[model samples]
Target: MSKALLVHPDDSVATLVEPVAAGESVTFAAQVVTALTDVPSGHKVAIRVISAGDPVVKFGFPIGTARTDIAVGAHVHTHNLATALDGTLDYRFTPSVPFVREAVAETATFQGYVRSDGRVGTRNEIWVLPTVGCVARTATRIAALADAAHGGAVDGVHAFTHPFGCSQLGDDLAGTRSILAALACHPNAGGVVIVGLGCESNQIAALLAEIPEARRSAIRTLSTQLAGDEIDEGVALVAELVALAKAERTTVGVDKLVLGVKCGGSDGLSGLTANPLVGRMSEAVVDAGGSVLLTEIPEMFGAERLLMDRAADEVVFDRTVKMVNDFKRYFLDHGEPVSENPSPGNLAGGITTLEEKSLGAVQKAGRAIVSDVIPYGGQVSRAGLTLLEAPGNDAVSCTALAAAGATAILFTTGRGTPLGFPVPTIKIASNSGLAARKPGWIDLDAGAVLEDGFDAVADDLLARLCDIASGAPTAAERNGEREIAIWKRGVTL
Candidate 1:
C-alpha cells in the first residue's frame, strides 16, 4: 500500500498516490475509514462525508463544490465535483499575509557573458532567424553549416523559423516583427543571421529597423535571391558569424540575469509547493537587482486584479489590464471560451477551471511589484517583475519569454513533463511522487514543503536556482529537450 498525504490538518481531502480498493481500511488522521470507492493516483479522497453544493476543500481552500452527495472515503474528482465558477458567487480577495524575513541587502552574483550593450547572457549561440516562410529551409541549412563549422565550441546553432511573417495585416504583422526583433536582441544570442527571400512581405530591412540600435550590429541579413540560391554561400556566411560567436565567453553577475517563470502539468500540489518556492526565488532575484518575467496572460484570468494592484504605476496597470482583455478577446474570437484552459491532465490532477488554475499559477510571481507589461516579443528594458502578454501553452510561452531576453527559466510541473527551452530550464516537480517517478526530468523536488515547511523548500529552491544560473545543467538541458513555439494570432493564411 502506498501513502496518501493530507496537505494540511484542516484539509477535508487527501491525495492518493496509489489506488485504494473499495472497502479497504485506510488510515487518515488518527482514524481508519473503509474506502468507499477506488481512488487512483493524483486523485483525491474525502476523509468525511460531504453533501451536494458543499465546497470541496484542498490546501485548506475551496477548490470546487460537490455536484452530488459524496460519502466518506469517496473519490473526489471531476465526475463528483465541479468548479466554483459553476456556482453563483463572486470570490472576495483577502490578501494572504506570507511570513516575511528581513530583506537580504547584500548582492548575490553569478558569472555570465556580458554584451557590449551592458546586457548579460547565460549562454552564447548563433541564431538563424528566417524572416519569411520562403527562406525557412535556407535558415535551416545555415544552422547545419554553422554547427559543422564551429564543431563543439559554439553551444549550438538554431533556426527559429515560423509559419507566419507573410500575408498578415495590422497588429498581426506588427506582432511578428516585434517577436523577431526581440529574438535578435536576446542575450543568449551572440549573433543572428536573418535569412529572407527578397520579394517576401517580411523584408529584412523592416525587421532590422525594429531592433534596438545597440543590438543591430550583431544582426546580419542575407536573402536567398541575393545568395543566388547557392546553399554553400549562405552556409559560408553563417559559418563566419558562428566563428565570431564561439570566441565570446561567459562573465557577469546574477543581477544581469533575466529569469522566466512558467508552470505546466499542474496538480493540487502546485500551489502547495513548487509555485510558491519559485515565487520566493523570484523575489530573491528581484531583490538582488535582477529582472524576472511572469507571462501566460490567460493563466492570469482570475488573478489579474492581484497583479493590477501591484503595478508600479497607472500606466503599467492599464497595460496589464489591456493584455488580459486582449487574451480574452483572442480566445472568444476563435469561438472558444477563455475558460477552456487547464488541459485534461490538469483536470485529472484536480484543477477544475481557468480561475482555479490561475489563482495557483499566479503564485509563481511571488510578492514582487509589477514593473511593466510587455506584449509578446517586446523587449524587456525595465527590471523587476514584468507581465509578458502570452498564452499558457508551455512551448509558446517559454519561447516568448526566451525571445524577450530571459537568460534562463524556472519551469514548474506537477503531472510530469519533459520539455526544455533554447535556454536553460530548471524543472521543479510539485510533488515528490512525480520527482521520484520521473527523476530524469525533474531537477528539484518541492514536494518536501508538504511534509516539512514552505521556508525549508524555498531555501532549497533558491540554492538550486543559484546552481543552475552558474552553469549547472538542469534535467531538461541534459535530455536535450530544446522546445520552442511562438504564439500565433490572426489568420494563418
Candidate 2:
C-alpha cells in the first residue's frame, strides 16, 4: 500500500490510508520523509510546517485553519485544525472548461413496470399507508396479512408508518398530507390501503383529496374504530389491494423512470470518485428524458448558489432559495448553527466544515438544470434535476425521495453503510478498501475511478443500475435491510 495519498499537488496535507507510526520514514510520490507524529487511518498529516492560523489545505481547498503552531509531518485533525467562517474557499459551478461527454452506450434498458400515469417503476408493491400514529398497528397488521397471502405473486407488501399524521397544524399538516398522497400515487405502488382512526386530525378525506382523481380510486381506506376494531377487516382490505397490485406488469423505457441520488458516510474520495460517477449516470438518465431527484437540504448548504444559477426559471430559483433559508431557520430555532454539520465520521474522513461537505455533496446532482424545489414531504412533479427539502439523514432522505415517486435510488458511501429503501438502492463504494472489506453491502466499486479511469468505472455503474432496475437484487435488498423514515415537521400530542 502507498504510504500517503496527495489529493492535489497544491495540498499541504497527505492522507494516510493506514496507520503510520511516528519516526518512521516513508516515501510519498518522489520524496521520502520521516513521520513526526503518528497518523491514524483516514486522517491527514502535514507535509510541511504550518504556523498558527495558517490554512490547512486538502483536495486543493481550505478545509480549516491550524489552531496552533504545527511542525512538518505533524498530524492535522480537530485538535489542531479549527473550522472558521472566514477561509479561502472556492467553488466551481460552471467549470472554466466544459466537461466532455464520454460517448459509450450499450443499448442498455431495464424491464420496469409502467404506471398509468406514464411513470416507470422498478418494483410493483402494494403500500400500506398509515395517516396517523393511532392506526400504525393496523397498517402493520395489514402489511403482514398481505405479505403472507400474496407472498408468491407480488413483490412485497410494505408498511409506511409514521409517528405524526395527526396533531399537526398549518405547514406541518399540509406537508404530511402531501407526502402520504405522493406515496399513494407513486409508480412503484400499484395499490395503496390507507389506515386511519375516524376522528384523527389528518382525515382520510383530506389525504384522498390531494391525490389525482384517477389514483384515488385505487386506494382503499379503513378505520379501525368503524370496523369494530376487528384487525381481520384491515387484513382483508389489504389482501385485496395486493391482488390488485399483482396485476401490473413490467415494461421497458427511460421515460418511465424516476431516480433519486443520495450520499452517506462520505469521505475525501466521495467527490473525487463515486459521487461524480453517479453524476454521470444521472446525466444519462436526464438525457433520456427521465427525472433525477436530489435531496438532503443541509448537504446543499453552501452549494445552493450553484443550483440557483442552474435553475430552469425564476420561480424554480426562488423556491430553491426559500427551501435553503427555511432549513437554516429550522436548525437555528433549535439553538443549533446551520453550519454545525459534518458529523464525527465526516471529520475522521477529512471533511472539516459544512461548506467542504456541501461542495462534495452537490456533485451528485450533475450539471442538469434545476427544474423545481419541493418542500419537505412534498411530491416531485417536474422532471430533470429537482431538489427535495429533506434532512441529511440517510433513512429520512431515502424515504422522502421514494414518496416523491423515485422508483430507484443511487446511494454513494465512503465509510460504508448497509441500509436500503423500499425501492431498490444501488450502493456505490467511494473507495476500494471499503468495497473489498464490506463485500456484502457495496454493490459497485467506484474507487477504480481514482486509480484506473473514470469512464470505465462509470460504465460499470450504469450496467449495475440497469441490472438492479431489471430485477437483479442489490446487496441491500438481498440482506432485507429495507429501512424508511419520514421527516416530521410538527408537534405530536
Candidate 3:
C-alpha cells in the first residue's frame, strides 16, 4: 500500500496512511520526500510548496489558508493552517448531473412490523416516555418494572428520558412537545406510554393533541399528579398496550425503508473509507425507492454546495439555501463562528478545519439528490434524500434522526461511541483498529475498505443492515443503551 494517499490529483497535501517519523521518506503523489518532522497517522503532510495566505488543498478543495510557509513533507495542521470559511455568502443553484432513479430488485424485503398507518417498523418494543423531567425517574422505573414483568412477551421495554419538559418557552417547549409526539408515534414502538407531570409546561393532554388521532390507539397516557401510584399505573397501562402491540412480523418491501445516515467520532479515514461506504449503501437503498435522511447541518459549513447542486428541483434548492444560511445565522446569533465547528478530538484525529470535516461528513449521503428539508422536530416529508436541521453532536443528531422516522440508522465513526437512539443504530468503524478495540460498539468495519474495497465492504454492510432491520439486535440494543435527546433551542421561562 502507498505510504500516503493523494485524495485527488490537485491536492496540495496528502494524508499519511500511517504515521511518519522525522527524516523518514514517504511516497506522496509519486514523489519521494523525507519528512521534516513526525506526522501522526491520518494527518496531512504537505506535498507541494505553499506560501502564507495561499490555500491548502485536500479532496480537491481548499480546506484552509496556509498560516505560514509550508515546505514539502512538513506537517500541515492547526499551527500552520487556518479556516477559509467566512460568514454566509450568496448562493445560486447549479444543477449537477440529472438524477436517474436506478432499478432495484423487486423482491427486496426485510422482516418488520407493518404499522396500520403504512409505516414499517424494525422493532416491536414498548417505549415509556416522560413529558417532563420531574417524572423522568418515574417513567424509567415504570419501564424497568414493566419490562421485567412483561419482557418475555415483546422485543424489549425501554424508557427515553430527558431533563427539559418544564421551564422551556417558545420553540423550546414546542420542540419538546413535537419530539415527544413524534416518539409516541414512532413505528418501532409497538406500544407507547407517555408519562407526564400534570403541572409541567408540557402537559400530557396538550402533547397528546400534537399526535394524529388515528395514531393514538397505540399510545397510553399517565398524569403522575392525578394517578394513584403512577409507577403501578404506568406498568399496568403498558400491560394493556401489550395487546395493542402484537409481535407479529411480516416481510416488508425495501421501498418502505427510511434510513438515517450519520457519522460521529470521525477520523481522517472517515471521509476516505467509512462515509463513502455508507454513501454506497445509501445509493443502493435510494435506488430501491427507499428514503435516506442526513443531518448535522452545521458540519455542512464549507461543503454545502455539494448537496445544493444535487437538489431535486428549484424548490428543494431554495430550501437547501435557507437551511444552510439559517444555521450560519444561528451560530452568529449566539456569538459563535460558523467555520469553527470541528472539535479538539477532530483535530487529534487529523481534521484541521470545519471545511475539511464538512467535506468528509457530507459523503454519507452518497450521490443522492436532495429531495426535502425537514425542520428540527419534523418527519421526512418525502422520499429520496432529505436533509434535516440539527447540530453535529452525536446524541442530538442521532435522536433527531430517530424522531424523523428512521427505522435503522447507519452511523459511521473512527472514534467509537456506545450510545444508541430509539432505532437500531448500526455503528461502522472507519478503521479496523477501532473496530477491533471496540468490537461490542461497532457492528460493521469499514476499515476493511482499505483491503477489501468499498463495494465488497459495503455489500457486507448492507446485508448486515438487512439482518439488523429484520430483527437482529445491534450492539447498542443488546447492551440496553436506548436513549433520546430533545433539541433545546429556546430560552427558559
Instruction: Please give the range of 10 consecutive residues that has the lowest summed lDDT in model 2.
Output: 87-96
Model 1 misplaced stretches (Cα beyond 4 Å): 1-14, 17-19, 23-35, 47-50, 59-61, 86-100, 103-107, 246-252, 313-315, 437-439, 448-460
- Write candidate 2's Cα lDDT for 35-122 as tens digits: 7877666567788888899887765667667899987778777788876543123333342232336434325588888767777778
Q: Among these predicted structures, which one has the highest TM-score?
A: 3
Clash statistics: count for each candidate: 3, 1, 0
TM-score of 2: 0.89
Model 2 local distance difference test score: 0.79
Q: Which pairs clash (backbone N, Cα, C closer than 3 Å) in model 1?
A: 110-254, 112-251, 112-252
Candidates in order have lDDT scores of 0.78, 0.79, 0.89
Cα lDDT of model 3 by residue, 149-226, tens digit: 998888889999999999999888999898888888888999899999889999888998999999888889999999
Lowest-sum lDDT 10-residue window in model 1? 86-95
Q: Between prediction 2 and prediction 3, which has the larger TM-score?
A: 3
Off by over 4 Å in 2: 1-10, 24-34, 47-51, 70-72, 86-106, 247-251, 313-315
Q: What is the lDDT of residue 272 in candidate 3?
A: 89
lDDT of 1 by residue, 1-493 (tens): 4457676777777776556888876665566666787766666788888899998776566666889999888878878877664211233333343335554523556666777778887777788888887777778877887677774776777777777678877778888888888888887888888888888777889999988787776777887787765477666766777667754555455677798999999986686578988888778777777889999888887667778777777778777777787777777777877677779889877676666688789889888888888878776888889988888889989988988889889999998888888788999998888999999999989888767888777777766776677667789878867756766666655
Candidate 3 segments exceeding 4 Å error: 28-31, 99-107
- Against the hidden true structure, what lDDT does model 3 obtain? 0.89
Q: In the order shown, what is each candidate's alpha-carbon RMSD?
A: 3.4, 3.3, 1.5
